[model samples]
Target: MIDSHIHADTRPFEDFELMAVSGIEGALTCAHDPLEMTSFDVVMAHFRRLLTVDPERAARNGLKLHIALGIHPRAIPHDPERVIEKLPDLLRNPSVVAVGEVGLESGSEIEMDVFKVQLKVADELGYPVIVHTPRRRKAEITSQIMDLIDGTMDESMVVIEHVNRDVLPELVETECMLGLTVQPEKLTPEGAVEILREYGTDRFVLNSDMSSAPSDPLSVPRTVQRMKMEGFSRRDIRQVSDGNIRDLLKISQI
Candidate 1:
């Protein structure tokens, strides 16, 4: 099973060891808002360390790992040009799968500016993106991003994440992939199952969004179990758990 969007860099090493034992086959480890309070060099250094440690740890423990590098919207006072300048070189890493955790956190002008630049860069590089929708008024935030990306980017190449029931209609209107984060106080296992039942699993992926807050790493696995209990067939489960992301990962060139 793959937790498609996770801040693996934020978790302790033992947490990954636990994930390995829990049948989590792989994860896309995303860099959080390092630029929010840290220097660019510091952020880059952390990413560099994660790119090295995560894959090695995963490989040694029989788990697969991938990376997504970007300046998160929550990171303020960021130089979009600096990130754009460094992105090309970073994308060259074979383990890096996408450019993301990028999008509007506040739907502010600065956030939108950086989001637009990354969207353009990802489009130019032919890489898939993992977008972060705002916690408040996610529909509005997602709509804002779609508007920004209207002409310059392809919706199909993006994963608009942290979505929920309120934002479903807005997301369904686009060709982009939908991510359901199974974090506590967010989307529950039952809620995700209902979404799959109601909407079908096409262009959908599941994640635990682990290590961000008080959460459960087993959330994805638990969600899968509940889906099974709810009479979703193995093939249906596979589609959300692995197949959708497997297709997305193909764009990585890893």
Candidate 2:
């Protein structure tokens, strides 16, 4: 399955190398603040890096990387106008896939403004929006995100990521797709399998959300394997592991 969100800058290429060996098709590589010039410059840098690393990546059968550039809501709030200016030009890059890791958070007023701006940018261009809800406070965080999405984004166009046990019901009620990272964070593979069984295994996408710390677990396939042991049908395992992401990314295969 495609990792819908990732930051290659913070993690070494080695981590990605391992994931590719596990059957990851591609990871949409993303980054936040730039070390230098214009916002577009950051977009250019990720694309440059993706091009540079891709052949080496292919040699090792690693996940192919795609790039997306936009302000993350965690850094600031939603601001429609400012985002409008930044995102349109950024999307011009053919390697850039979507506008994201942007959305509501339990941040200050400024953060809300910035998120709204980027969300509008996603809407304007019809780009798929990758929404981030606060990991520290998943329930309160999800409420904030749901409110924003209800007012702005089409439910089908947004992918709410890093979903854990907390907002599972809200996830079903809102009918918004979810991205679950099964790496060695607070959650375990067994625990994640329980979630899939409870969540109905539809419209739920799996991701790895890798970094340098701990194992990536090559989460998609790992989760798929566990679900099978837990009595999940082969068809359901494939649905969450790969099928949903194909639909969410609007691509043929991961």
Candidate 3:
């Protein structure tokens, strides 16, 4: 199984071992704003960690780590154009899979402008994107995000993350995939299973969204176990836990 979204740089090395031992084969670590104040140099340094430090650490612990680079909404630097210009070249790296963990946080004008610029970059590069929806004003902001994605790029190339039941219906009709995050303050294992049953497993993918905050590194495997207890078929389990994300990111099975 692959964790579709995670901030591996924020996790302890032991967590990777636990995830690997729990049957998680790979994970995609996305760039996020971890500090109170972010600068262009800081963002570039974080990207370097995602590319160089994090992958090697995960590999040593037995998990294959993939990277997704972008300026997260909350992490937007003073001069975003510099970061945007660097993305095309940075995204060409073999380990980087998408432009992600980017989208509306406060829904400010600057946030929207930066989000659109990153979306355009991803669209032109033909890379998948992992968009974020905040806990507060989720419905309203997600609606705006959907609107931005409508004609801007291929909806199929985007996966909106941290989605809950309230916003699930809005995304169902769209071509983008739904990211069901199982973690503290997000969906529980039981809730995730319930969603799979109601929504079916075609366009859904499971993730832990593990990061500096409280999270469960083995959330995906634990969710799989819940699905089994509920009598979900093996194929259905594979589709959500592994296949859907692999198909979206074009990652190989480990």
TM-score of each: 0.93, 0.83, 0.98
**Cα distance off (Å), candidate 2, residue 77:** 11
The residue-level lDDT of candidate 2 at 254 comes to 31
Better of 2 and 3 by TM-score: 3
* Ten residues in sequence with the least summed lDDT for candidate 1: 34-43
The order by descending TM-score is: 3, 1, 2
Q: Candidate 1 local accuracy as lDDT?
A: 0.82
Number of colliding residue pairs in model 2: 17
lDDT of 2 by residue, 117-224 (tens): 777777778877777777678888788777777777788888888887788777878767887777786566787788877767887877766655464646776776
Give lDDT tens digits, candidate 3, residues 89-112. Answer: 999999999998899998999999
Give RMSD (Å) of candidate 1 vs. truth.
2.1
- Candidate 3: give the clashing pairs: none
Segments of candidate 3 deviating more than 4 angstroms: none
Best by lDDT: 3
Candidate 3 residue 117 Cα shift, in angstroms, is: 0.8
lDDT for every model? 0.82, 0.68, 0.92
Report each candidate's C-alpha RMSD, comma-separated, in the order given: 2.1, 3.4, 0.8
